[model samples]
Target: MDVDPLLTQARQLWIELAGAPVAFPTRGVAVVASAESSTCPPGWVGIVALGDAAICTVPTDDLVGVVTRACHMLPVAALTDPERLAAVLPVTQVLGPATLAYCDDHSYRPQRRQPIEQLPVHHPDLVDFLASVPAEDAAECGLTDITSAAYVLRAGTAIVAAAGYRHWPRRVAHLSVLTAPSRRGRGLARAVAGAATADSLADGLVPQWRARPAASRRVARALGFRELGAQLSVRVGGSDQTRLGPGSNTTAP
Candidate 1:
């Protein structure tokens, strides 16, 4: 009867693990990354509430511990552990003995993006366009069924920019394949973003862009994606860094 509690728990754990808002966090929050993104009946789901935090479970005692003790924290903190972070997949954790020092901060908030009227679909010259890109990039974009999802702008494709989503449900869509470095200063980001936002709106979902660079957020602004705040990824046995959770956004949802 009351699914709100389960939904809240799953969403919170998803935010903790994935570092972004999740639209439909599954009933098994402890294993959310591995769980199928399906909504479950409230009665079938178990809940574990601790202080201000709660996690959805599969009606098992061990699952309760994993959800309450292990899986509930800000993403930035959880990401520091290699084994734990690996479970989240696609998100890299900086290991020790690395050259780069990890840091956390929001560089800036992007300006609001203007809407786009028409996006020209690329024609049969498309083979050359597809050839320019790697297959992994295409797979990432096509994860959400947006057809013709390949081609980065810097490769000198006509579209100027390309973008696509990873379905974490409506509350969260990972925006990937933003643009190539050589394609900067064009309105490609706006065009691609406008199209993606329109798709999300059509699906009755809220779009949350993930892990965008500070410069990329400028493009996001033109495409109607305000910052959900900056997220941090720290390396193990690395130098000290301050971390914030969901507070560094220039624009709040």
Candidate 2:
């Protein structure tokens, strides 16, 4: 695979979404933040790391200083670890410590053995497919929310698997893939995801795979997506935007 462009593209994509790079006490870990951080998935803090470079977005500006301090003090491993993030903030909920991956023209292994149908992401067939999935699985996969056209594998009128991408900042195709619980273990996720990813690349979009579940990650790996780093979203306090981020709070992971 082409390493230089991949590295540069991945690094710049996160910078655009989160913020510009800033100095950190740690050598390997660089930090960045921007106004966009406020909208970052309703978490106390959202950190998108590539290799040793971590781009963090907190809900508020005041938290930047405290989060930065924690970045300097925490090891790279700790910074990327969702539970370990409690060392700095209140740490109410953790969304991920997910593996971040990207695909290159050379690396992507398109799965063409299975037939796939492309449709508007919100099409009824795709909607019903998502509806058939277990609630928890549907929520976790986030496929129903994709803005790109869907690539689907159907079982009669029902969709057994689906894949698409959310249009994220920096033209990133944040890939979403879901296989119905009853239809899994059939290589269905990869077959459809491969089509969606191929289409995204053809349109000159960068494909991103933020895989949380081991099964999802496995499918991404099988399609030749290269894992680069991790993403961890931390939220503290109750429903209120409390002081955990900016003020003093030291809870261990």
lDDT of 1: 0.36
User: Which segments of candidate 1 are over 4 A away from where they belong?
Assistant: 1-67, 71-127, 134-136, 147-157, 164-177, 185-187, 199-205, 212-218, 227-253
TM-score of 1: 0.42
Clashes of 2: 1
* Pairs in clash, predicted candidate 1: 113-221, 113-222
Q: Give the TM-score of candidate 2.
A: 0.82
Summing lDDT over every window of 10 consecutive residues in candidate 1, give the lowest-scoring window: 96-105
Residue-wise C-alpha lDDT for candidate 2, range 4-107, written one tens digit per residue: 66656777776665544443222355544454442245435777667656667765567778777877777675777865678776777766677778997888
Model 1's C-alpha root-mean-square deviation from the true structure amounts to 11.9
How far in Å is the alpha carbon of 139 misplaced in model 2?
2.7
